[model samples]
Target: MRRRAWLHVAVLAALVAAATPFTAGAAASAAGRSSTSASPTLMAPVTRTFTFNGTPQSYTVPAGAVVTITADGAGGATINCTYTGKGGTGGRVVTTLPATSAPTTYTLTVGGSGGKGCTPSHSGGAGGYNGGGRGGPVLVDGTGFDGGGGGGASSVAANGQLLVVAAGGGGSGGVVLGGPPTGNGGDGGPDGTAGTAGGARPNAGVGGGGGGGGSTS
Candidate 1:
């Protein structure tokens, strides 16, 4: 996501537009391993991690099992002297949501990492867990967590409920020539949270990392 010579004002908007909410499941995890059948609660919780590189994953929740999910977004590439691409947003922690119908299997999709832009371009930030895919991190739940990643969304839905969580911040451009008040740094979305702008040569570099969206880490 390097700054192009003729970048339109909407480029940033496009990136923001691509963002979406995340989601997760109800039951917790199993202690040592995944359980087939159980009571109402799991003896130990089960944990899952997604990288968003391969096919989506599938999981089944028995009558009484607890599962914990963790994921990261893909990171952006580094640029030469152009604007920095936005980092992947952070992922969220999700828990207990009523399913459409009491069934077992669940499908999960981890976010993939962002790719580098061409010359004068920079790399995108990485995605976070189940919430923001790290441009490239993760998602889930009406009420989940916010791991550290760039380009994440505010909230997500899973099993029919919304999983509220943190989103990632935007990247900055090479540097500012004149005065724009705000530097080349891209602003954070949903809440107007601002990113640090860049300075002139020698001082010019990529944008600072955006604040985490309720990150657990």
Candidate 2:
């Protein structure tokens, strides 16, 4: 009886010793898994703004990043000299950009406001930055009436490819002696329309229409 009890106790001890390593290994693996799951990698969000500077600007972004782009074209210039027509407003655009797998660089072209003052008689206004058109001039009773300049277009590009564009507004035109009410300026892109011409009066210079804004597809 004594021998049998000793044999039973030795077997039980051996079993416990064999199971100890497996239980400890399982507990260690579970702890490692918990630690790994507690911490994760995250990406930060980015935001930027662009404005007219008469030159192209550059921006860089991370790979697989989502981007939102908004652009606005410049407004046409007005003539403070006389009771001339008012300039048109610029166009606005908002869009979402596609994600790129590699780090990307984008080029920005901001629109410039139209120039003021042409000069002398029958002298037209200068074009705005980017793609704005020139303004029309007039002469009435041998007196010169200078015209206002057109606004410029804004655009964005990626890898030398054009992504989007917002068109500019048309400039104000001059008046005629008995001309049609005052001349009206053209609206900006999307609706890109031309300005109205001045009315005809004997011995009075006839005014020309302002150029239309550029359009995008």
Candidate 3:
């Protein structure tokens, strides 16, 4: 009976030791899983590029798309376009505001032409004459901002033959900022000749002096 009791006690001790290792291993596995699940995740930023009219463009925008427009070459013209998305404005010349947005169509128009010679006496300079300028009707668009007017000729009696002849003056160049059109008309050749009219405002050229009358002894 004593031997049997001792044997039972030894078996119980062996069982306890075996169970302890399983519990410890389970705890260690659970700790490893918990640490793996709690770790932080990292993501990379998104980037994209857009090309328009041979120009390369790029943006680091969020998950979305953007529209773009541009103008090239010379022509009295303005751009027109349509936009869709938040903060959109309809069909109009975009002079100010968001730099990213732009027009699709480039519409150009000729500017008014310079005035012509009415008669030697009434002839105006080449550019921006007859109400000519940036806003003139006959003027070509994008020709230039401010153009000079032609010079006037000396008055003569009807059917009267005059020997003195004068040439009209050339127009002045236009400025960057929309300034006045028309330059001073060249002075008549030598004597008593009328001077050409100057541009509207901002730009004004010196008038041509009248040509001198036929020499008198």
Predictions: Cα RMSD each? 18.6, 22.9, 35.4
In candidate 2, stretches whose alpha carbon ends up further than 4 angstroms from where it belongs are 1-41, 139-142, 177-181, 191-204, 214-217
Worst 10 residues of 3 by lDDT: 1-10
Q: Give the residue spans of candidate 3 off by over 4 A.
A: 1-146, 157-160, 163-170, 177-186, 191-217
Each prediction's whole-model lDDT (CA): 0.29, 0.56, 0.21
Evaluated against the true structure, the overall lDDT of model 2 is: 0.56
Q: Which candidate leads in TM-score?
A: 2
Candidate 1 on 1-217: residue-level lDDT in tens? 3211100000010001122443333443423444443223213434443334334455555532333333322232222333332332333333344322333455544433222222221322333232322221112121111121333333323464433232333322222223122122232333323222222232233222322322212
Model 1 spans with C-alpha error above 4 angstroms: 1-44, 71-101, 118-169, 174-217
Q: Candidate 2, residues 1-217: lDDT per residue as tens digits?
A: 0000000000001001122222235777777743222222335455667777779888776566666776667666665554556666667666777666667788888777665533535656666777777766666444445456667777778987888676777666655544453455565654323222222224456554444443453
Rank order by lDDT, top first? Answer: 2, 1, 3
Alpha-carbon deviation at 57 in model 2, angstroms: 0.6
Q: Pick by lDDT: which candidate is best?
A: 2
TM-score of each: 0.37, 0.69, 0.19
